[model samples]
Target: MKTIVKRSSVFFLICLILLMPISSFAHGMILKLEEPGVLKVEYDGGGFSPRTEITIYDEEGNELGKGPVDEEGKFHFDPGMKVHSAIADDGMGHRAEYKEGVEEKNIPKVPVVIGVFAVIAVIFVLFNKKAKARQQ
Candidate 1:
């Protein structure tokens, strides 16, 4: 009975884990204001976002510039002080918005990856009590 419970739990947990990235990819891309003019695009999961489109708008809701992010997921242009908002889109459903009053955090890649791994580790330990008891 315990084995069956463990197996079912593991199966469900794995399914949930696999689905996380797929769902996130559609809505997890974020645009960071890297010193006002420099815009950085990246997945919420971490690393470069391929072929993201970027648009910058002024305070009056006029587009100052619009273009594709580079292969490195970066776009650079100085729209001067009148900047109001920016949008990043991957054209595959992932979109992120940066507005004047609402600031999006530019989460560092290494730390975010580490945090995710840590969560997975915690979940593993929860399911496998024996694993935690075993110490090298």
Candidate 2:
């Protein structure tokens, strides 16, 4: 009988834990922009009590859009013009943007693979030197 009571209490606690909001402690905020300049930002809803305000900005430091996050910690931007950057201050400022030359820089995989392998080789040599010193 005592074991059964303990198990029931544990089950109730687990259910409460599951029901709690997991996003409350998460700092993994995300921002996305769709084609023709539609932006979306999401957060864990930490700073807002009634709902937090989000602001959009341009590369020229101009305000584009402003709104609040919904109950689900989600926001949408419907800027009719092209957007270069977005800024959000949910206590910690979140910033993102679309760069002008990004499309041109995203070239084919040959250059990217060579760059990645070059970085890897430099890191490996530095670590290998440290390991050899420790062994000696």
Candidate 3:
């Protein structure tokens, strides 16, 4: 009886572990501006449906450009005019959008540079100490 219960418990634990990865997947999409006049779109969840469409528009509701997402669930386009916003639709109910001039917090470069130099200095000091210990 003990052996049978232990075996069943192990089997249940293994099944739970295997199914955890499937639950981690989330269904969503995202649109971002790569640069001035350039936009990128990406889809999450599973593979993109065929002919996933992306469209850019101006503030006045004028169409800027439209295209289809590739097999890798990504698309990029350059809108000739100033863009106000953009939208992506997989035609199977998944959709996402990006509004123009969304302000991303600017991270100052000086702190990042200083942190890198500090790490390098620590590594150099450790190596130098190790070499000296070896010589003695």
Candidate 4:
């Protein structure tokens, strides 16, 4: 009986580890900003649905702009100049931060988005690992 319980516990732990990753990603939070000068950000509050706040920052880590998300989960930043970071906070209790100006290139958006996606993907992967372990 003892061995059975131990084996069952270990199995449950492994299963939780696997499923936890998908659960952590169950809620999707998206941020979008078209131009560096405009700094417009859009958010989608996963399925839970909630209000969100967005913030913009410069290379020096100074806050450039901030505001609450709109009804459709959107926020705009019109600093009229380039910035470094764009952060969002769901009023329901979730926050998301984005970093810009990492690359020293002035190329078209195709390359820029590829670079940005790579960075975001790395962040998500690391975060997912920790979140999954915690959920288990």
Candidate 5:
């Protein structure tokens, strides 16, 4: 009885290990903007989906440009001038998308920069403080 149980357990363990890799290959797609206008698409199973097709669309859902992903899985276009969002399809049921709404850059940055400096100053003062006993 003990030998039979041991053999069954070993077989189950081997099967589990063999099936785990299949799940890795079934991973979904991922899309990211490497920069303002450069888009990157990746398959979680692989490093990048090379030769995948990319479509750039404006806010109105009209196509602006269509192309294939390069070896680095990157596509380049002028987003600020015409494009709004993009989609990458591997033609094998793997699809990734970027759908950020475009808007004007009217916000000021000086105030935000000043606030960050203030935070750094406060942290520096706090950390540089000498112990009360040491001062005495």
Candidate 6:
């Protein structure tokens, strides 16, 4: 009857919602080089697409090395020479790249910490002086 149809429709909608992510996750990749000379790659989808290709390049755009990822969607490579960047491709147009080097920082940490402590000390001294004046 009408109740049976309603329950079936609800179940169908729930199934569709669960399967949507799988299709949406079909693309995307990530490349990282946490350690010097070694690069790591991962895919964004639920799991890595096997045999995904990866290429390494230097700052000058010279190819350093190239290889395929393992079944786990993870690839590790040691560029015999220094690499300035790396790129990962899932062969389906999903690609990602990372460049090596430190990002420019305007302010240094040590000076900032010292400045904060100095401000705190000045505020404490002013408060103590005010408290004493009120007592007198």
Best by lDDT: 1
For model 1, how does the per-residue alpha-carbon lDDT over 1-136 read when each residue is reduced to its tens digit? 5666668667857875876564322336777787767888887767765678899898889999989988778888874756788888888777888887786666555676678778877876675665334421
Candidate 5 wrong stretches, greater than 4 Å: 1-25, 101-136
How accurate locally is residue 135 in candidate 4, as Cα lDDT from 0 to 100?
55
Worst 10-residue lDDT window for candidate 6 reads 19-28
Full-model lDDT for every candidate: 0.74, 0.54, 0.66, 0.58, 0.70, 0.66
TM-score of every candidate relative to the true structure: 0.56, 0.37, 0.47, 0.47, 0.53, 0.48
Residue runs of model 1 more than 4 Å from their true location after superposition: 1-27, 79-81, 105-136
Q: What are the runs in model 4 whose C-alpha is more than 4 Å off?
A: 1-22, 36-50, 101-136
What would the per-residue lDDT of candidate 5 be over residues 87-112, giving only the tens digit for each residue? 89989888888777643242344575
Per-residue error (Å), model 6, residue 44: 2.9
Candidate 4, pairs of clashing residues: 51-91
Poorest 10 consecutive residues by lDDT, candidate 1: 127-136
Q: Tens digit of lDDT per residue, candidate 2, span 35-116? A: 4544445543433322446677677979878777666545566647656666544555543333433531224445755776
Range of the 10 consecutive residues with the lowest summed lDDT in candidate 5: 127-136
The C-alpha RMSD in Å for every predicted model, in order, reads 6.8, 15.5, 14.1, 12.0, 17.6, 18.9
Error of 1 at 7 (Å): 17
- Per-residue lDDT of candidate 3, residues 17-126 (tens digit): 57444423345666677777555566553355656788888899899788886666556565467788888887877777888868544344458657755765686566
Shift of residue 41 alpha carbon in model 3, Å? 2.0
- Runs in model 6 deviating more than 4 A are 1-27, 102-136
Over 21-72, each residue of candidate 6 has an lDDT whose tens digit, in order, gives: 3533244566777566555666544566676788888789999788887765
Residue-pair clashes per prediction, in order, are 0, 0, 0, 1, 0, 0
* Tens digits of per-residue lDDT for model 4, 46-131: 43233566787778988887777665555655647566787776665555666773432223545755675576568656655665
Candidate 5 C-alpha error for residue 135, in Å? 82
Alpha carbon lDDT of residue 92, candidate 6? Answer: 81
